[model samples]
Target: MMKRNRSCVLALCVAAALGTASLGGCSVGEALHEGVTAVAESASKAARFDVSGTIEQTTMLDNDVLTVVAESLEYRNDVAYLKLSLTNNTEGTIDVTACTGGYDANYVNDCMLSEGYFSCEIPAGETAEDEVDFSLQELQLYGIQKISVLGLGLRVVDEEYDELFKDMVEVKTLLYGSEGVDSSTFAGSIDSPALAEKLEYEFKAASTTAPDLAETDIEIPAAFLFINKDGDIAVMAELRNNTEETLRVQAGNITINGLAAYEGESWSGGTVAAGKRGVMSLRLSSVVEYGDLLFDSSKAAEDADSTEGKEGVDLSNVKEIGMTISTKDANGNTISDPVDVAFAF
Candidate 1:
C-alpha cells in the first residue's frame, strides 16, 4: 500500500464534499465524504477550478451479496474524489475497505495519488453513498490541465470482520470528457523504468548538474532540479537497484544553503525491486513545515508570528543543498550507512 498520512486529507474531503468547514479550519474531514448529493455547489464555488467530467454509473462489483457502482467524480482544490454507491443486497451489514492494487487515470499517471478507499459499513438491504479522495499532485507537477478517467480498487468484508471479498476489486470509470484520450500510453507502475525516463526528461530541461551517489550495486542515474507546482524547490532522484532484494531509500539531515531544512516523508521513497528502477522525490519548501507547501501562506504567517525570536531558514536564497541518503532492506535493516552528498545548481 502507498504511504498516506497527510493531516488534512480528511479536511480537504470534508470541505469539498460537504461544502462546509473553512479550508482554514479543516484539519481532518470524515474519510468517507458521505453526503446526500454529488458535487456540492458550494464546493465548486470554493475550489480553484471545477472538473468538467462525468463518471457514468459503472458497476464495479455485482454478485449475490453486494453491488458497487461509481456514481461520479469531482475535482476541487487539487484534490479529486469519486463518489460511490454501494448496495448491500445481503442480509447483514458489510465493511468495505481499501486494500492494494491501483490503476492510472487520465492526467494522473501510475495512480500514485490514490489515498485508499474510505472504510465504511452498509446495513443490510440499504445503499450507502460516499466519496473517496485522491491527490492531484502528479497531474499538477506534470502541468496537466485535464482529467479524463478515474480508477479505483477496493475490498469488502463481512460484519464478522471476515473477508467476504478476498482480493482487491479494480474499477476503471471513464469520465465523459476523456472521449478521445488514450490513458494506456501513460499508465504504469510507479517503480517501473518509466521513472528513469521521467527524471531524465526533467533533467534535460531543468538540471544544471546530475550527481550520482556511489554505492555497491545501486546507482543514482538522474536527479532533476526544478520548482514544483507548489513553488518549492524539488529534486526528482531516480535510482536503479541492481541487487537481489527490494531496497527502500530515504533522506535524512537535509540542509539548504548550510541551514537546517525540513526533512519530511518523501513523495516517493524510491522503493524498488531487484533489477528495477524507482524514484525518490525530495523538496525544500519551508524549514518549519514537515511536508511540501501544500497549504496557503497564511499558515506560514501564523507560524512566523508564533516564533518571533527564533531564526528562520531562507529558502529563497539557496546556494547549496546537502543531505545524507540512506538505504535499507525490506525488513528495515540498514543496508549501508548514510552517505553525505552535496549539490549546487
Candidate 2:
C-alpha cells in the first residue's frame, strides 16, 4: 500500500495544535482535504496496531444499534490513538462528519477528530474500519477513552467534506435531534464501568514474544523495555540511519502504552542527525517491573524460571512491540521499504 503525504498531515497537526478555525483560518472542510493527504496517511500507521488475535474493547451501543470494537489503543510519541471498527445497524445512514473521543464522565476533555468523515463512513448497516489519530491536546494519552462525533449539513458539497465546522466544536449530537437539522450532533458518550476495564480492554492485543526484524536502511539496532535509571518506565530504541544522505526522521512512535512523551524535542529515538547511529528514549506512561521490560531473546532462556515464580507482576503481559520510524530527504521524497523493529522482551 502507498503512504499518504506527510507534509499535509503535519500542517493539520500545526493547525489543530494552534486551535485555528480553518487550519489556522483556512476554513474547516477545506482543511481536511488539504491536510488529510497527510493525516489519512497515518492509517497506514494503523498496521502497527495489528495485534493479530487480541480482542480489546468491543462495546455495543443500544444493543448493537451501533457496535464498536476498539481493537487497540496505543500511545506513540504524544498522541492517543484508537484503531476501531464501528457498525451502524440503525435506521438510516449516520453521517459522522466530525468526532470528539470523550474519555471522561464529564465531556470536559477529549481528542477531537473533526476530519473523521474523510477517513470512513458508517452508511447504515456498514462498518467504518479506520484508525483514528487523536491529538493529546490536553488529555493524557495512556488512559482508557471513548469516541464521539459532531459535524455539518451540506448546501454546497466540498471535495473534502459535506460542509464546514464553522468553529462549532460542541458534541451536540449526543442529544439525538441535532443530526439532520443543518449540522451534525455529538454522539453521546459511552460510559464504561471502571478505569481498570478500560485499560485492559484498550491495550489487549496479540503481540510478538521474540522479534526477528528484517534489516532496513533506517534501523532500530538495540531495543529495551526497562525502568530507566531515573525510575521511569521507558522504551529506549537505538535507531541508526544507515543511509548516507541526511535523512530526517519525520516522526517517531513506540506504541506500547505508558511513556507519555518522547524524551527529546526533535527525534523520539534521539536525533538521527546526518549520521547513522543514535538512541531514542520514549518515556513510559507509568513504571513497570525492571526485569520484564529488560527481557529479549538471549536472556529469555535464563529468566524463564525466575520470572514465573515471581509474585505481583506478570511477565507474560510484557509482549513484544512494533516500532515505526518515518524518514524523508531534502527533496521531500519518502524513504521506503519499512520493516518492523522489535522490543521483544
Worst 10-residue lDDT window for candidate 2 reads 182-191
List TM-score per model, in order: 0.45, 0.26
Q: lDDT of model 1 at residue 297?
A: 41
Model 2 C-alpha lDDT per residue in residues 1-345, reported as the tens digit of each score: 111112111122233332322221212232212211111221221102111222245442323345555566555654544465656665555544322221011121222222222223456677777554443322212121322322211111123544312122222213223222212111111111132122111112122332333233565544544321122233444445555664444333333322211222223311233333433444333222232343232333344466532332232244444445555553435664333344544
The TM-score that candidate 1 achieves is 0.45
Query: On residues 22-49, what C-alpha lDDT tens digit does candidate 1 reach at each position?
Result: 4332111222122201222222211122
Misplaced by over 4 Å in model 1 are 1-53, 61-67, 74-81, 87-111, 114-126, 133-140, 143-149, 153-170, 173-253, 258-312, 322-343
TM-score, cand. 2 vs. native: 0.26
lDDT of each: 0.48, 0.33
Q: In every candidate, how many clashes are there?
A: 2, 21
